[model samples]
Target: MNEKQIEGLLEQHGIKLTANRILIAKVMSTLDYPISMKELETMLLTMDKSSIFRTLSLFKSHHLVHQMEDGNDIVRYELCHSHSEEEDEDIHVHFYCEHCHRTFCLNEISVPQVNLPVGYRQTAVNYMIKGICPDCSHR
Candidate 1:
């Protein structure tokens, strides 16, 4: 997205717009896969590590993005596609490919709804499915 569009989104999510913040958001928008801060650092030509962390912190607070820890044990992030203010803290599925070591959003592969134990409470369900992706499968 352009600066104006990114700025508006940041405002909508009650986040402050900075150059680093906008760049991070833009990279997430461009990718159909989840990415690590390190990956983003390389993608963003002008990013500084500290700035990226701050931007991610703001994004997490506002539900502009979501983080997942795959079996690979890295914290990866992707844009939250839902426009609703609610369910911002809900659990979603993430797909990770071992061969490629890339994570993708499984938006349609939502976590199945089930009853919780009488006294149990749900916070978030982070489910990561690991396998080889199409490209790797072809090799």
Candidate 2:
């Protein structure tokens, strides 16, 4: 995405646009799947780890990004595709390929809704499936 697009997205999510935040958001916009902190750090060598984490935290609070734990217990972050600022439309099942150690977003596969008991609340849901990817299986 271009700087203008990124700026508009951030503004839509009620997040302040800064150089670091814009850079982070731009990098994330180009990714096809969720990314862990380590991988993001590797890609963003110019920025420090804490800065990235801080920006991610802000993004999550503003519903600009989705944060979830993968099969390996590593936290991954992805841009939220929901157009509405009040709702998150990007929630879906994620697949962790054992062979490739990569996480894939199954956008077509909807996450099963959960029925909570009385007085129970659900803030977030993470459904991760672990298996070999198509490439690994083909090989």
Candidate 3:
């Protein structure tokens, strides 16, 4: 997405269009898969790590992004596709390639719903599948 579209998205989500936030959002918009903090740091070398982390935290809290653990001990973040700021419609599965050590967002497959026991509450869910990805399988 272009900077203008990115800015509009942020504005729609009620987020301030700061330079750092815009840069991060732009990068996230261009990437097809989730990205880890280390990867983002490598990509945005000029930005401070703490600033990036703070921006990510803010984005997640505002439902502008969603985070997931890929069973690799590192958390990755992806832009949320929800229409409203308070709602998150990006409840989908993630695929982790054991061979290449890369995590992918399986947006087409929705996360299955689960029934809870009495008085039980569900806040969040993470569904990850680990295996060889297409690239690894082809190799």
Candidate 4:
């Protein structure tokens, strides 16, 4: 996505637009897979690690991004496809490639709803499957 589109997305999520935030969001938008903080830092050479972490933290708080753990226990971030600030519509299963150590969003597969016990509440769900990805399998 372009810078303007990124700005619009941040605004939609009620996040204040900054050059660093827009740059981070822009990089995230260009990638199809979820990225870790270290990977993002490598891509965003102009920004410091702390600044990126802060931006990601802000993004997570606003629900503009989904923070998830890959099978290897590394945290990854992906843009939330939902348009509403109060509701997240893009919840889905994730795939972790053990071969390449990459995280992918399985958008076609939906997360199954679970029945919680009495007095229990559900806020989020993370379902990750680990295996060799298509590219690795083809090798």
Residue pairs whose backbone atoms clash in candidate 1: none
- Per-candidate TM vs. native? 0.84, 0.94, 0.94, 0.94
Q: How close is candidate 1 to the true structure, as a TM-score?
A: 0.84
Q: Write the per-residue lDDT of candidate 2 for residues 29-100, one digit (tens) a residue.
A: 999899999999999999999999999999988888999998888999999977766668779999999988
**What tens-digit string does per-residue lDDT give for candidate 1 at 45-117?**
5778888888887787778888779768988888775554345644578888899887777777778887998
Q: Which residue pairs come into collision in candidate 2?
A: none
- Candidate 2 deviates by what RMSD? 1.1
lDDT of each: 0.78, 0.91, 0.91, 0.90
Q: Going through the candidates in order, what is the number of backbone clashes in each? A: 0, 0, 0, 0
lDDT of 2 at 51: 99
lDDT (10s digit) by residue, model 4, range 74-129: 89999987897876788899999999887888999999989999999888788899
lDDT of 3 by residue, 1-139 (tens): 9999889888888899899999999999999999999999999999999999999998988888988898697999999877668878778999999999998888999999999999999777779999999999999
Lowest-sum lDDT 10-residue window in model 1: 82-91
TM-score of 4: 0.94
Give lDDT for model 3: 0.91
Whole-model alpha-carbon lDDT for candidate 2: 0.91
Which pairs of residues collide in candidate 3?
none
